[model samples]
Target chain A: MNRIACIISYDGTNFSGYQVQPNKRTVQLEIEQALKRVHKGQEVSVTASGRTDAGVHAKGQVIHFDSPFRIPAAQWPKALNACLPDDIRVLSARYAEKDFHARYHTTGKEYRYRVLNAEDPDVFRRHHSAHVSYALDIDKMRQAAAYLIGTHDFSAFCAANTSVIDKVRTLYAVDINVHEDELHFILRGNGFLYNMVRIIVGTLLEVGYGKRTAQSVDTALRTCKRDDAGKTAPPQGLYLWSVQYND
Target chain B: MNRIACIISYDGTNFSGYQVQPNKRTVQLEIEQALKRVHKGQEVSVTASGRTDAGVHAKGQVIHFDSPFRIPAAQWPKALNACLPDDIRVLSARYAEKDFHARYHTTGKEYRYRVLNAEDPDVFRRHHSAHVSYALDIDKMRQAAAYLIGTHDFSAFCAANTSVIDKVRTLYAVDINVHEDELHFILRGNGFLYNMVRIIVGTLLEVGYGKRTAQSVDTALRTCKRDDAGKTAPPQGLYLWSVQYND
Candidate 1:
C-alpha cells in the first residue's frame, strides 16, 4: 500500500467539528466517506494534522491515508475531488514515506483570527468574520501580542478541560495586522494546545478594548491559570491557515 | 414628511429578487417591513434605483422612502437594522431633497461580475463568485471588452424577453482585472437593460475561452440580435456595486 499525503481546505461552517461524532456532520467523516467511495466501499481511515472546532475554517490542513490503488499522485486531487463535497477540497497529493505521519510529524502550525471592527456588520462577510462594533486600540493589541512570543507554558491559553499534562510550547511569532476595518491576528508556533489560538486572540482583544492590560499576558503565562485569560473567541473567526511538517 | 435615502447591502442567495412579489421573499419586502415596524405599523412605500435579479448581490444599493416620523437621518440605520434580518444591512442613511427620486434621478450604475477561474471551487466564496474550471485567455477577453466600451444599442446583450423598447445605452467603461485565480469585470454605464451585464459577461467569457473571436463583439453590437451574443451568465456572479446620481 502507498502512503499518500494530501493538503486539504474546508469551510467548517456547517460541520460539527473536524472529528467525527455519532450522527453528526464533520469534516473528517465527509473526507473518509469520499475516500471510501474511491476505495470501492472499503473503509479508509484518514488522519489529519489536528482537530478544528465547529465553524472554524481551514485553508491548508494536511492529512494522510494508505491506499492500495496506484494512481499518479498528481491526479489524486481530481480523483478525490470528484467524490468529495464542495466545501472540502483536496488541494494537492503526493506519495509519502511509509513512516510519515500527518499528525505526529508536524513541525508547526499557523492560525488566523479575523475581527470585523465596524459599527455596521458586513452582510457578505458575516459568516466568515467575527463582528466587533466597539472601537479597538491596535497599538494595545500589538503590545499584548508581543508578550506572547517565545517558549512558555500556555496552560492559561488552552481550554480548561483539556487532559494534556504538558502545556509548554514554543511560539515563533504573534502578529496583529490591520486592513481597513478588519484586524487579523496571525499566530505561528511549534505546536498549540486545544483552544489556544482563540483564547490568545480573546485576551489580546480585551487588551485592545482596555478591559485588560498588556502585562496581563505575562501574568497569565507565569501563573498558568485559565481563569486569568479572557473569554474564548468564537469559532467563526478562526482559520487553520497552514500546517508545517519537516520534509 | 421626511425623505430618507439609505445605502443598503444584501446577500441575495436566499431572496427571489429585489422586487416585491406576493408570497415571495425579496429585499424590498424586508426593507419595507423593517420601516413599517419603525414607523409603528404604518405602511411606508420605498423606491429603489433598480431591481436586481435573484441570487445577485449588492454592496451599495440606494433606496428612498418617505416617513411621517421625524427621527434624525443619522439614526435611521441603527433603528432599521434592529428589525432587519442578518442577510441585509442599512450601511448609511441621510435626508434627501424633497424632489429626489431614487429610480428616476439616477444618472448611472456600476456592476461587478466575479469569475473564479480555477480548477477547484472556493467553498467560502461559492455563493458570491461564479466558478469556471476551463482555462481562459485574459488578453482575448480584454480585446473583446474594448469593443464594448462605447455608446451603442445593446439589444444583443440583453435578455430576449425584456419589454423595454429602447436598447441604446452609453457604456462609460468596461474593465477586466485579474487577481490571482479570479477575474473581475467592472462595468459602468448610463443605464442597463434586463440581464445586460450578465449577457455581456457571458459573451466576454466565450471570447476568453476562444469560442468566439474579439471581432464578434462588434458584430453582435451591429446586428443588435439577441442570438448574436452568448448566453446569459448566472446571477450569483453579479453584484450591483453602486449607483451614481447627479446630485
Candidate 2:
C-alpha cells in the first residue's frame, strides 16, 4: 500500500462540515466516498489536517490516505477529481512517507476572514463574505489586532465547550487589509483553539465600532474568561487558507 | 407616477433567464415581485436594457420602472432591496426623465466572458467562470479578436435560430486580457445579436486551440454564414458588465 498526501480545495457552502457525521453531507464523507469508488468498492478511510466548521471554505486543505492502487502521484488528482463533486477538487497529490500524518505532523496554519464593509451586500459575495453595514474604523481595528499578536492563553477567545486544557498558543501574525469595500483579516499561528480566530475578529470589530477599547483585548488575555471577549464571528466568512508542515 | 432608473446586480445562478416565463423563476420576475410587494399588491412593470440568458450574471444592469410612491431617489435602492432576494441587489437608484426608456435609450453595452485556463477547476470560481483545461495560445485569440472589431454583419457569430433581421452591429472594442490563469474577453459594442458574444468567444477559443487560423474570422465575417464560425460558448462565463445610456 502507498500513502498519498493530497492538497484539496472545497466550497463549504453546502457542506455540514469537514468531518464525517451520520447522514449529514460533509467534505470528509465525499472524499472517502470518491476514494471508495476509485478503489472499486474497497472502503478507504481519509484523514484531514483538521476539522473546519460548516460553511467555512478551504483553499489549501491537506489530507492523507492509504491506498492499495498503484496510480502515480501526479495522476492521482486527475483520477480522484473525475469521481469527486464539482464543489470539491483535488488540487495536487503526492506520495508521502509511511510515517507521515496529516493531522499530527502539522506545524502551523493560516486563516482568512472576509467582511464586506459596504452599505449594501454584494450579490456575488453572499456566500463568500459577511456583510457589515456599520462603518468600521480601520485604525482602531489595527490597534486592537496588535494586542492579539504574540503568545497568549486565548481561553477568552475560544469556544466555551472545548475540552482542550492548554489554551496557550503563539500567534505569528495578524494582518488586516482593506480591498476596496472588503476587509480581509489574515491570521497565522502555530495553533488555534476552537473559534479562536472568529472570536478575535469579533472583538476587533467591536473595537472598530467603538464598543470596546484596544486595551480591553489585553485585559481579556489576562483574565482568560470566555465572557471577556466578543461574540464569535459567523462561519461563512472564514477560510482555512493553508496548512504548514515540517517535512 | 415617477420614472425611476436603477442599476442592479445579480448572481443569475438560480434564475431561468432575465425575462419572465410562465412558472419559471427569472430576474424580471423577482424584480417585479419585489416591486409588487413594495407597492402593497399594486402591480408594477419593469423594463431592462436587455435580456440575458440563464446563468449569465450582471454587474451593472439598468432597469426602469414607474412607481406611485414618493420615496426619495437615494432611498429607493434600500427600500427595494429589502423586498428582493439575496441573489439580486439594487446598486443605485435615481429619478429619470419621463421620456426616458431603459430599453430604447441605451447607447452601448459592455459584456465580459471569463475563461479559467487552468489544469484543474477552482472550486470557488465554479459558478463564475468556464473551465478550459487545454493550453491556449493567447496571441492567436487576440489576433482573431482584432478581426472581429469594427462595424460588420455578425450573422456568422450569432445563433442560428435568432429571428433578428438586421445582424449588423458596430463593435467598438474586443479586448482579450490575461490575468493569471484566467482570460477575460471584454466586448464593448453598440448592440449584439443572440449569442453574439458567446459565439465570438467560441470562435476565438477555436483559434487559440489551433483548430482554426486567425484569418478564418475575417472570412466568417465576410461570408456571414453561421456554420463558418465555431460553436456557442456556455452562458455561465458571460456577464452583462454594464449598459450605456446617453442622457
User: DockQ, per-model, please?
Assistant: 0.70, 0.82
lDDT tens digits, residue span A1-247, model 2:
8999999999999999999999999999999999999999999999999999999999999999999887778889988999999999999999999988999999999999999999888888898988888899999899989988999999999999999999999999999999989999999999999999899999988988899998899999999999999989888899999999998
* Model 2: how far residue A212 lies from native, Å: 1.8
Residue range B1-247, candidate 1, lDDT tens digits: 8898999999998899999999999999999999999989999988999999899999999999998777877789999999999999999899999989999999999999999999878888988999998899999998999999889999999998889998999999999999888999999999999999999999999999989999999999999999999989999899999999999
Q: How close is candidate 2 to the true structure, as a TM-score?
A: 0.96
Q: Lowest summed lDDT over 10 consecutive residues: which window, candidate 2 chain A?
A: A67-76
What are the per-residue Cα lDDT tens digits for candidate 1 across A138-175?
Answer: 99888888889999999999999999999999999999
**Candidate 1 error regions (>4 Å):** B21-24
lDDT of 2 by residue, B1-247 (tens): 8999999999989999899999999999999999999999999999999999999999999999999887889889988899999999999999999988999989999999999999878898899898888899999889899988899999999999988999999999999999989999999999989999999999999999999999999999999999999989889899999999998
**Runs in model 2 lying further than 4 Å from the true structure:** none
Chain A TM-scores in order? 0.98, 0.99
